[model samples]
Target: MTFRECQRCGTCCEKGGPALHEADLGLLEHIPMSDVVCLRRGEMAFDPRTQSLQPLSAELMKIRGKDRGWECIYFLSQAKTCSIYSHRPLECRSLFCADTAAVLEAMAVPTLSRQDMVPQESALWDCITDHENNFPVGQALRLAKAETDFAGSICSELDDLIRREIHFRQVLADRVQAADRDLWAYLGRPLWLVLLPLNPIFSRYEHA
Candidate 1:
């Protein structure tokens, strides 16, 4: 299997399934943050939604599931293409098909097996590392990562810590939005509030 072998079936591209990454955020410069969808603290949502974000409690919220999670608002269904293809995020570009996997393995760098690919964690890490590199949506990534890692029991005690931080940041964002009557004002601030308290742990990853 190889990249050239891809049929461009678009089976993997439809329905807003893939999570956004830091590089995706960078590629999405032209798209307003309001237009992109994201999962925050295990909840699915887009900007301007009237209700709380949807909790991803079931497998249906996954890419392998029927609904395939949230779709990108800019994705064009008719052409089976991304409306913002050129500027699409890194995660989108990084996604490999069966052919791509075979090619990579043939070249000697065995990609992780499918069972090892935790889409949520990978997306969360991409967001965090990229946000730290100065992307605007990193705050959301921080919240998402905290929620994801906490839920996985990787460090169970950190679950409450992360949740508390997420709640605090959400409250702060709400206040900022109320005062400024704008959502962008709250974007970067959440990361600041959440990361400040975890400076000891985060500092280790700063150089990573």
Candidate 2:
């Protein structure tokens, strides 16, 4: 049987929050920065088309998951309703599991990046840029692979980088009086957590 309208089963919402696109810019005011996280370029993330984790070609802002899990933060699971149905992101509005043509086409369009979300001249934007350049996930993942499979001598360097990542965010937070949630929203997740999937060794540095 073909379904004509949404069943509100929450299947799509449970998979993960939709990636923000240009059309969703107007809705940003309704969505708090603390609820967003930039999936930086080169970071490995779930690719719906491929059904596997693939490195993102470009940075895209996504609604952070509930309690760091993949469930869309705005999804009201028990009630089976959207917290912001009136003005959900473009991907959300476009998605239809039965026929994903609309959603796939929406994915082809340019996504909203960190620069698009924040003013280019602001200190906050500068800090985000610096963090991306200085602590890139690709470089960290490469270092982790080397440590796990090769010389293992680079452990110290990787450890140092992890510590620097913590300090970098700490100093920026103190200077700007930014809260931890805001810091995560602006700079993406911590390096240690991001690297955890690549290597279990990084788990020890989680609290560092």
Candidate 3:
């Protein structure tokens, strides 16, 4: 078997950082939301490999990679080093883009969950899961991203989606003070971030 040795060329880092999977959840206690983002199912991203819109199957907590245009937030471009090299995620440790077999195999494993949690953390986790399931933003988001022919339906879905977000925020805020921000994190990136990609579709509908 052959393996690729990294040349410290920084090409991989520029491609972006590894996602935060089940094994990486513990790092959240130390990593701030500014550096990491949770991607909900609603965000429609183009998948180059699939040549289609890549819809998420589950909630994905990923590192914010575009701070420097698709570069990892922890990437020190000038020095060609990762700022948080010592504490990188497991996916990062297993990855070697030149020989992607390991990373591909790792992805087949189920996402990790907290085996043991204290009462407070457990409560929050439960609420997050419940809200995510109950709200079902995927359909609304998909409709909102559709072509102009679905303008009326898109409008309706967007309204419903926003209302659901507001209601969920209320539920979270009731559980703890200042949880509105946490709501965004739990839903993945900021609401505006999700909206950015769909803005063009929205504009076309409005004008038409």
Top model number, TM-score = 2
lDDT of 1 at 113: 21
Supply the TM-score for candidate 3: 0.66
Question: Where is model 2 poorest over a 10-residue stretch in terms of lDDT?
Answer: 145-154
The per-residue C-alpha lDDT of model 1 at residue 74 equals: 51
lDDT per residue, candidate 2, 1-208, as tens digits? 8897898899999988989888888998899888888887888999888889999888879988887577999999999999999989989988988899999999887888887877989988888878888898888887877775543334777778888988998898788888655766688888888887765666676566
lDDT of 3 at 33: 58
User: lDDT per prediction?
Assistant: 0.39, 0.83, 0.61
Model 1 lDDT tens row, 1-208: 4555456567656534444432233443475544432222322333212334443331111112122234545556677776667775444565556534432333232222211222545643444334334433344345535654442332444434444444544554475464211222122233323343433344332222
- For model 1, what is the alpha-carbon lDDT of residue 32? 50
- Model 3: residues with Cα > 4 Å off, grouped in runs: 1-4, 42-53, 66-70, 113-123, 126-135, 146-157, 163-184, 201-208
In model 2, what are the clashing residue pairs, if there are any? none
RMSD of each: 14.9, 2.2, 5.4
Ordered by TM-score, highest first, the candidates read 2, 3, 1
